[model samples]
Target: MRALVLDRPGTCDTLRPAELPTPLPGPGRVRVRVEACGLNPSDYQRAAYGIPEWEWPAILGLDVVGLVDTLGEGVTAVGLGQRVAFHGDIRERGGFADYALADATVLAPVPDGLEPARAAALPSAGLTAHQAVVRRLRVGKDDTVLVTGGAGGVGGFAVQLAARAGARVIATEAAHNTDHVKRLGADAVIDFRGEDIAARVRELTDGRGVDAVVDTIGSDSATANLGLLVHGGGLAAVAGRPDLNAVAPFGLAPSVHEIALGAAYLLGDHRSRVQLSIMLAELLEMAADGRLDPMLSRTVPFEDVPGALVELSGRQVRGKIVYVAS
Candidate 1:
């Protein structure tokens, strides 16, 4: 199998093309013949600073859409040749090659007529947004929700899902993506580069603050958003950890939800891992019916994975990028 192999943790230059033995599925796993793999910021992060549980010579492409070639022993849910998409576990070698392995529990069949590249864009980002908005925040009708990075992969879906749930969606993006995020169901778009996001959200909510905030761009953004929520409102963080202490003095009773889609695999949380597949199925159905957009902005040939990682690491990508198998 031809794979972009990472022998050591470093920059994108550390990735090199090599013909490696194709991986086979072990018990309770499935081997997918790679069709498309999506690029994500986490890909570059893992490549540059390795995961604590990951081994050397890793392959890093997390959002994978492909056909199941073989099923390991005791796997009864999926069968051979079924087209599937899943968020590849980063602790294992990922989908950046001709064949990739996954636990069968995580596979969701790609809806008919959905393009592989489009499906490839969904699993990780879509799952995160779904879990944050639907499961954690429970965004509902007439509620005002704020989504940071609104034009981004996860934020785009968060906007749509919140809107579909009858919530008024507020999103933050670069000035240029204001129109794009609006089309994705964001009722208001704030330009984080130039505008005061907190002030704008207050204005939009008439000084009440949002019912909940889905924070995709974490770090300081997460902590800042805590102050923009109504008392008892939720904030779901997908990226970095937010300082809960920031809201301590206010006694806002803010609901802080930590969303880590891959943590289910890391902590051996079987129930949450199973819910990932359910979330993928629901997301794929929405995409197939046009209720959700994969937000795929670019499709490149598989060999461009290395350069694509470099491009993604730059943090200028507005939407998802998927690389198809040659």
Candidate 2:
């Protein structure tokens, strides 16, 4: 099998194509013949900053949409040739190759109408959004929620999921993405480049601030989102951690949460894995029924993985980019 392997943690140039043996399923695991894999922030993050746990010549990718080629012993829930999507572990084998190994317990069966690329896009970003908005923040119908970077992958899904739950969502995005955010169900869009996000939220909420905030950009944006919440509201961040002092000035006493979907799926407890599988299944069903779009931005063949990594690292992408397995 051909795969893009990182000889050592470095730039995109370090990711080189090479012939490698296909991974086989172990006990409680399954070998998937990968059809499509989604590019995520973590992929480039590992490339830029080395992951100590990932050995050299590693295949780095997370989301996998493929067919179950072989099953390990003790796995009877899914059968051979069954279409499934799963969260690949970079610490083990990943989806950048022709075949990847995954724990059968975390696999979700893909519905008939969902394409491989779209299904591949859902596991990481969609699951993160679901966990952040639905579980961590506990957004309700009458609540006003603000999503930072609402036009991007996780943010887009957050907007949709929050909207689906009947929350009035406000999103921070580029002026060009106004319609994009609105289509994802944002009740209002703030042009982050030109507008004051916290001020806008205050104005939109009649100086009361939002009931919850899903912060995807992190850094200063996460700190800013902490201040934009109503007193005693909730917050979730995908990238940055909130400063205790920053939240102190709000008088809101917001409950801060860090959303780490990758860790939960790859290294979490049994209950976490069950919740991830259930969310992936629900997301797959929604995509199959045309209720959710994975927001597929582009599809590239496997050979172009290096260039794609560079492009993704530049960080201008609006939605998910998928790689079709060769």
| Top candidate by lDDT | 1
Compared with the true structure, all predictions reach lDDT values of 0.90, 0.87
Off by over 4 Å in 2: 265-267
Residue 203 accuracy (lDDT) in model 1: 89
TM-score for candidate 2, residues paired by index: 0.96
Q: Quote each prediction's TM-score.
A: 0.97, 0.96
Candidate 2 pairs with clashing backbones: none
Error of 2 at 174 (Å): 1.2
What are the per-model C-alpha RMSD values against the true structure? 1.3, 1.5
The residue pairs found clashing in candidate 1 are none
lDDT of 1: 0.90
> Candidate 2, 266: how far from true, in Å?
6.1
**Candidate 2 weakest lDDT stretch, 10 residues:** 242-251
- The list of candidate 1 runs beyond 4 A from truth reads 248-250
- Model 2 clash tally, residue pairs: 0
